[model samples]
Target chain A: MSDTSLTIRRFADLANPTRFLALSARLLPWICWLTAALFGLGLFYALTSAGDYQQGETVRIMYVHVPSAWLAMMTYMVMTLSALGTLVWRHPLADVSARAAMPIGAAFTALALVTGSLWGKPMWGAWWVWDARLTSFFILFLMYLGLIALNRALEDPTRAARLSAILILLGFINIPIIKFSVDWWNTLHQPASVLRMGGSAIDGEFLRPLLLMAGAFTCLFLALHLGAMRNEILRRRVAALRRQAARGALTAGGPA
Target chain B: MSLDAPHIGFVLASYGAALAIILGLILWVLLDGRARRAEIRALEAAGIRRRSDRPVDDARAAGPAP
Candidate 1:
């Protein structure tokens, strides 16, 4: 077979929930270990690093806050791709992935809000602000909750997945808004520093630990996401078995 | 790193909240995975075969072949 078809075949094979479960089971432990190790190193570096000349010790909050924010957005982006897979490719695992990621993304978004508030209280002299960036992020959190609620409210699994995917695709508009809010409007929130078009404004001393923490957070998300997907697959399997058992009983009882 | 820094409460609170939420999420996912696995094991023990566990020749079989 040609390389392109071979690649497509391999990708198509993962649509088998059983194969995906086995693959995730093998990958999860290693991802968990890496998450733990990276978190350990990240925390150590974040704590021991020199205080910022301007922001002082409170700059330390950025270590945790920035990564959470990044992951919050990144997780949504993952869900968006998964949504595409669900709607366009009709991949079974796609809905599973998008559903699995919802809570994790919500938690991270909440973390970002809380930590950002904590950081803001001292730096911006307020616990909350109505700035574009902050408001956009809050909307993202609500969107996450809405997606979760939409999934649960619908009884039909396939229909629920389709509806949620459409919502996710629609909600993705907030992502770029959240990213560029600082630039588009004068806001208390700082503009993009690490992921700017020109270059990062953060000094190397702070950037190192910040990057380490980002890596740790990414690993944590992956580990948690994989675990959740595994559980979801098992859930479907159990449901199928129960349905089968009920059918067996009904059929066996009829007109013997 | 210094606990005595001014506004240290905010710093500690931020880290504390983040730690609590992140750790809680991790614990929840781990427990959920464990519970699901155990449930699957119990189902299998009761002779409810998983789709993957069935013989290849039974590919066309449905509803446990009752």
Candidate 2:
């Protein structure tokens, strides 16, 4: 097989819950340790880094705010991919992963919005404005909530997964809008400085801490995602066992 | 880290909120994993077999014969 096919096969093999569980159990501890270490280093850099000449101490919020925003978008992207996995590939873990990620994604998005508002009150002299970027981000949070609710509202697991997958794909359209809102319109939120066509406009002193914190947040998300997926898989297993037990009881109580 | 910066409350609030939300999420996931694992252990101890734990051919043959 070609390298690409080999990689695909390996991923396909992970659809076996037992293998996935074993892999997760081995990796989760290391991922957790890495997350803690990264957060420690990231916090040191963020706290000790030089203050911005323009925003002064308030720039400190950027360390947390930017990472939360990045994770918010990134998490949704993950869900979108998982949705594709469920719909196109019929990968067993896809729905579980997408479901497992929703709460974490919602939390990050909420953090982003709250921190953004906190940053805004001081900078923009208003807690909020219906700017394109901010509004789109708010919509992203709502989309996450909607998906979570829809997942719960359906009775059949297969049906829930299918419907939610469709919704996830449909909701993905908002991501690019959130990313380019500032550029597309006159928004109070700043345009892309770190990620832009012409490269980052941020100073190195601030950039280092920002990158460090971003790494920490990314690590945190991964560790949490893996942990959540493990839990979800176990939950499914428990449900299956319960169903089997019920069947066994019915059989024993009946004519046999 | 100075206490006297103007509008510093906003910075504190923002960081506090982030810390609270992130920590809460971590705690929630951990507790949930622990709870589910305990429940699974209890179920297994009560002699309930997982679908995967059953022999495949036996399960197939025993279907509707339980």
Query: What C-alpha lDDT do the candidate models reach, one value each?
Result: 0.91, 0.92
Put down candidate 1 lDDT per residue, A50-146, tens digits, no spaces.
Answer: 9887778999999999999999999999999999999999999999999999999999999999999998988889999998999999999999999
Model 2 TM: 0.95
The digit string of per-residue lDDT tens for model 1 on B1-66 reads 898988889889989998899889978887887888788788778877756686776645653444
Write down the lDDT that model 2 would get: 0.92
As for candidate 2, its clashing pairs are none
CA RMSD, predictions in order: 2.1, 2.1
Fnat of the models, one by one? 0.84, 0.74
Q: Candidate 1, after superposition: displacement of residue A184 in Å?
A: 0.7
Candidate that would win on lDDT: 2
TM-score of chain B of each: 0.77, 0.77
- The candidate 2 chain B region of ten consecutive residues with least summed lDDT is B57-66
CAPRI grade of model 1: medium
